[model samples]
Target: MPSTEITDDTFIRRYADDIAYVAQQPPATDLATLAAQLDTVAPRYEAAGITGHEDLETASLHLDEALRATGTDRDAFLRRAHNLLRPLVADMTQEYRLAAGD
Candidate 1:
């Protein structure tokens, strides 16, 4: 049977880790793979009304470009990526709590 309860919290936590890991140690190649991984989480954000989908898409492109260009700016890229993701996570957490009346 399909689960009725929303698992936004679980997704938020897991995706945050994924984002952090990617930002910290992005793959040597196949950046699209990373973006595709991120895409998996988009629906959860949309469901929670948390914006930044476009930002993630844009970031994915830039991150891939940056990784390919210098290959040594992972720190900077991580900072930018985390900056974009952190607020979305926070907002989603808040929305989930509010919806749950917690």
Candidate 2:
């Protein structure tokens, strides 16, 4: 959670936006790109010191499940991923926005 201040450069904002954007698209629209983006989350999370954030962990589980599925299975998982992650992303974005004084 944010306190009174946070930098706009924080990694979670971009990561949240990217995940939201990808999740909103039709699953088959770009599975390869989605997978590529999901692959970056771990290293980025480690760099961002995002451990113990429940929202992030939940969102990551959804993304990871989607990453491991294929074809129609992947599509199903992606749809659920969007549903599961949307609120987590929104909460994170709102915290960052408030901290940034937006």
Q: Identify the leading candidate in terms of TM-score.
A: 1
Best by lDDT: 1
Off by over 4 Å in 1: 1-34, 71-74, 93-102
How do the residues 1-102 of candidate 2 rate in per-residue lDDT, one tens digit apiece?
Answer: 833222113323434464434234332234344444544443444454444245454545655666677776765655555555445555544444454466
* Tens digits of lDDT, candidate 1, 2-41: 5333122433343554453424444323444555656554
TM-score for all models, in order of appearance: 0.44, 0.43
Residue 78's lDDT within candidate 1 is 44
lDDT of each: 0.52, 0.46
What's the distance in Å from true for residue 36, model 2? Answer: 9.6
Global local distance difference test of model 2: 0.46
